[model samples]
Target: MQNTTWGAIMGQPFGVIGYSNLGFVFDRDRIHEYQTYWPKEETGLARDVYIGFKYQCVEYARRFLTLKFKAAFTDIPHAHNIWALDIIEDCTKEEGTFPFVNYPNGSKEPPQFGDLIIYPYSKEQRFGHVGVILNVNLEEKYVDIGEQNYEEAGWECPEYARRLIMKIENGQYFITNKRIGKPYDNWDINEEIFGWKRIDFSQKQ
Candidate 1:
């Protein structure tokens, strides 16, 4: 948004950290881990899947955007414990079914306090998972999103044969994308834990 030092440091850019930058160097190892599999679900707990808030929000901020996975992982510092406590309660749900709600802007968008973290209730191969959309990108995609490791929030991969874009639809959140040059949608997993969304800290009272 503002792209200020704070934001820049928080989102993982390039040439943004160094030995002089203690903030960046603090969690350098995590960058190594994120690079190992980040932007790719292949990254799991023992493999980079830090499923909880640490991995979802805080650790996510640590990701620095760069062709190098480690560079992307160095995006933010001190994010782990920062966002674990907030909750987004204002997200607009549609028909409680499969529907994509539009988050306009300013006052019109959902007053989503933090990241709207959703856990997978089910699993279909590598597709079953979780994600965070802390705020609505009003100017650009207007698409609600958060720290997506893998690639630009990691929504473009077609795992499980053909799956991409994890979403919460009809009271159920699932992953969808495409396989073999085709659209593949909705692989509901109504039974998952650790998945969470973030509430806007600035908006909190």
Candidate 2:
């Protein structure tokens, strides 16, 4: 799969679907077609940073944080475990950590851009799933997210992988599993979104 700006959605398994808002989104349908072990040397990342398995949802979240904020959390056992994290290690500068905030699925706090959206564990996704929130459209009632290993199709938009419906009730936010259209995958009510985690940059010194 070539690393182009945009990928061709030719229904090819394990091919380059396209570039997300930050990192490349690869098709994770076929396990035999791609390498799951992505070493730091192979990924061109710092030796200390360990982003999860290659093309997994956690990998995209960590890689997005690393590329955009120059920070990342420690290795996690699963994608949903990220809800327990409170800070992210700074990859550059002072080598310190930045505190992050976790908002639950039905929180009054609305999700902002660049937040790490997490999905819960279920029969469909045993390891859970995570993605970067690209944009939040309260008016349109949808959120544009970028992720890998979620769907095996190409992105419908230039900057996002998929769009999930977001509804506000009594001033509380809820990101539903019901998708708008295109690149259909296995997202359903059972695969509920746990919430989103955002770095509090103001805590940075």
Winning model by TM-score:
2
Tens digits of per-residue lDDT for model 1, 30-110: 655433233334432122322222233333433322221222221222332222333222212211111112221122223
Tens-place lDDT digits, model 2, residues 70-134: 68888888888888888888666536888978999989999998888998787887988887888
Scored by lDDT, the top model is 2
Candidates' TM-scores? 0.27, 0.75
C-alpha RMSD for every candidate: 15.3, 6.6
In candidate 2, where is summed lDDT lowest over 10 consecutive residues? 9-18
Residue 163, model 1: lDDT of 26
